[model samples]
Target: MFKQLFETGIGVIAIAMLSWILIWMTRQARFLKAEITDSIKNALGEDNRADWGIFSLIFIAVFWEGLETALFIVAKFQEGWTPVLGAIAGLGVAVIIGMLLFKWSIRINLNQFFQVMGVFLLLIVSGLVISVLRHLDAAAIAFSHISSSTDLCGIGKNSCILRPQIWDFSASLADRQFLGILLKTIFGYTQKLYLIQAVGYLLFWTIVGSLYFRSLSQSTQLKPANKFN
Candidate 1:
């Protein structure tokens, strides 16, 4: 019971951090390079320690990503080795891609790359919103049992006070199946869903998606002006 509660708390924190980063990255897309250059210059001051400044910038960026990855892994630890393996594979792929883009000096459309990745990540995070709510609901039920409070879960075998069950697709496409699991992992698909979970999922997509798309469009509009200048 306590374990589930702890995991749920971690999920909340992970999702919150991911959502903030997604929105922030989108909004700062245009100014991020300049900001980083400015930060490095300020950090080095008149010393003009280009090497140290570059190293410091790299270290901080890597550390920030590493911290987020750790939190994400911990939040999804109960899902078995799949998430862990995926994370490792993703890191490997990212490293290779970084080498190709930078070390090899391969030309690629970074704007398109980031835009696509942003949308993909947004979908995944939105799904996590639902998953987190489910975890919270399960934890609440377990807590009720420990406290011997029947009011917390209402009636029925699967009844949850968090929100009434909206749909159950287990019979047609169970989350345990291959396709179902794929969707569940990638898109946050579930065999069963609750009112609050649905609302939370859609709301996240609506709010975050709006901000991201708006920022993207604004950046696109500014590109021509930047080119002209």
Candidate 2:
């Protein structure tokens, strides 16, 4: 019981942190370059070691990206090796892209790149919102069983706390199936979905998605004006 609860808590924290980071990045996308430049300039002015300041800046940036990647991988660990493999593939692609952009001095539309990736991540995290709620519900059910609390879940209910099961598509497109697993990994698809889970998923996309797209649009609008000025 304790172990299940602990794992669930970790998953929740990891998903929450990932979601927060994604949304924050969307909102700060426009200012990130300027902020980094300013930070580097400030660091360089603090001492005579300009090279050391630059190195420090690079170290911090790499450390932050690594931390985010670690958290994401940890969050997906319960799903088995598939997601891990996918993450490794993604890292390779990212490295290649970085080399092209930085080392080869290739020009890419960073704003568009971020916009597309932001949308993809938001979809994934929205699914994660559902996953977190389901995990909490499972933990609650497990605790109720261990404690012998019959009242926690009424008879014939599929969930102890997530409300009645809305639908079970396991007979048709079971989550264990190849396509189902793909959807589950990419979009958080589930064979059994509860009312609360559906509501939570939609609410995440509605609120977080709105904020992200709004910020993205604002950034796009401001970019041209800033360039002209």
Candidate 3:
């Protein structure tokens, strides 16, 4: 219990700090919503107005994301300290990288960094969609009462739609073991996924990937047109 609480505290603090860093970087990028900017800038001189407007936008965005991330870290930390430690290490590395980028005058291509991170974040969100579906399926099974004679393989409403096994890779990577745990933490991997989980995972990635690529294509087209103009 103490470990869990400690992990949660660490998670919360790390998320908050990261949120501040992200907000700062986003402001440096000059990426503020037009309405938010205009509304908050009404009282100030034009030059100072833009800065405060961006700050306000960053504050709101960071607050909301930080709260959400805190809740998420709390939930995930229950799995074990490995994830918590991993998150802490990741946060530390990010801080060091940020210091090097800013304080040490290290150069990095911001556009490329954002592009790569955008794709990675999208993949993580897709994995989350799968994880949520699997958790729901697990909950449904707990509520379901299975008789001794009942077939375990049946699907749909009349039978166990949730627990109809799709595949088991326990022989290779048992879910609770080190490698399995790391994979699961990073990619939402599972050795004993069910039919519903598989279907949901495929569907989520398909939809999100299509939308993502479409947006990228549109942006690419717009850039060339803008350049020509």
State which candidate has the highest lDDT: 1
All candidates' lDDT scores? 0.82, 0.81, 0.61
Flag regions of model 1 displaced more than 4 Å.
35-107, 224-229
TM-score of 2: 0.67
Which digits, one per residue and each the tens of the lDDT, describe model 1 over residues 1-229? 7776787788788878887898788777778767878876776786767778688879999999899998998887789998888888998999999999889998877788889999999889888887778787888777777676456775454746456788899999999998999999988898998888888988987887898898888888876554322
lDDT tens digits by residue: candidate 3, 1-229: 3343344455445434543444344434433344556666674654665767778889999899878867877887899997788777877898899899889998776555775775676555555555665555444444443545554434444324555677789998898999898778777788877777677767756765565555555554544333222
- Among all windows of 10 consecutive residues in model 1, the one with the lowest summed lDDT is 220-229
**What's model 2's lDDT at 70?**
96
Spell out the clash pairs found in candidate 2.
none
User: For residues 1-229, what per-residue lDDT tens digits would candidate 2 score against the true structure?
Assistant: 6666676688678767877787787777668877978977886788779868678879999999999999999999999998899899999999998999899998776667778898888888888777777778877777677676455876555688888789999999999999999999888899999999989888887887887788777777776454322
Q: What's the candidate order when arranged by decreasing lDDT?
A: 1, 2, 3
Indicate whether candidate 2 or candidate 3 has the larger TM-score. Answer: 2
What's the ranking of the predictions by TM-score, best on top?
A: 2, 1, 3
Name the lDDT of candidate 3: 0.61
